[model samples]
Target: MEKTYTVSVFTENSIGMMNRVTIVFTRRHLNIDSITASESEVPGVFRYTIVLRTTRQQVDKVVGQLEKVIDVIKAFVHEENDIVHQEVALYKIRTETLTNGDVEKVIREHHARVLTVDPQFMVIEKTGHVEETQLLFEKLRPYGVLEFARSGRVAVTKPMKELSTYLEEI
Candidate 1:
């Protein structure tokens, strides 16, 4: 069965490491749904949060391969329930929509915030699970969304232990 799995890869920041990590998926004929990379809690270490829809066996193999990468300090595969995750989505709605009270109502209902209000467009930002963002997008579509972008999943295990602890242990 195909189910979403979040792969959290911790590594030292280096050039061409992403290419190598992504290539492993390509070689295995897997599709990467989303990928987000940013500095982690530990200084100098970076985290790559990659989302993929595949079976447990495949995800296990992929994580194993990722851990073998020279720069990869650790790699973990987590099911949706195992981690606390969120994605940020930004919607650029037509400024004219702001004239009517409907847009504001929708934003309040969804708990979304207006990041910027420009004459040409008003940017609304929502940070939540995938479904939450999709629901907001659906509601805002009628108002005219000039642009919509959602970032890849960023996740951390639910356990209280920080990744830095694991890094120190190893």
Candidate 2:
């Protein structure tokens, strides 16, 4: 069965590494649902959180192939229950539509923050699971949303051991 899987890839900083890693999945005809890359806890290492909907066997194959890429230090596959994940979404709404107190109520109900306010528009930010962000977008659509963007999934495993800990052991 196909389900969401998070691939945690660790690598040394190097040019073209992302492309190489991504190509592994592409060659297998897999679609990446979302991906976020950032510096890892260790100063020189980087981590990529890649989400995809695939069977366990395919994800395992992808991770194995990712590990073969140059500069790739390690690759891990995690089920949703194994990790804590979040995505950030930003919404721009026209100011005229947010003139009433109801706007504040809506924001409060959604646990979103107004990042900036101008005479013409307001920017609202929300960080949570993807589903929450999508729901907020649906709710705001009726209120004249001018723009919207959601970042890819960013996640860490729930295990007490940190990535840095493993890096240290090496």
Among these predictions, the greatest lDDT belongs to: 1
Q: For all candidates, what are the clash counts? A: 0, 0
Residues 1-170, candidate 1: write the lDDT tens digits.
99999999999999999998999899899999999999999999999999999999999999999889899999989998999999999999999988879999999999999999988999999999999999999999999999999999988889788887898899
Off by over 4 Å in 1: none
Task: Encode model 2's per-residue lDDT on 1-170: one tens digit a residue.
Answer: 99999999999999998898899999999999998999988889999999999999999999989888889988999999999999999999999987788777889999999999999999999999999999999988889999999999999899898887777776
TM-score of each: 0.95, 0.96
Error of 1 at 155 (Å): 1.1
How big is the positional error of residue 93 in model 1, measured in Å on the Cα after superposition? 1.0
Q: Which portions of model 2 show Cα errors greater than 4 Å?
A: 168-170
User: Could you give me the TM-score of model 2 versus the true structure?
Assistant: 0.96
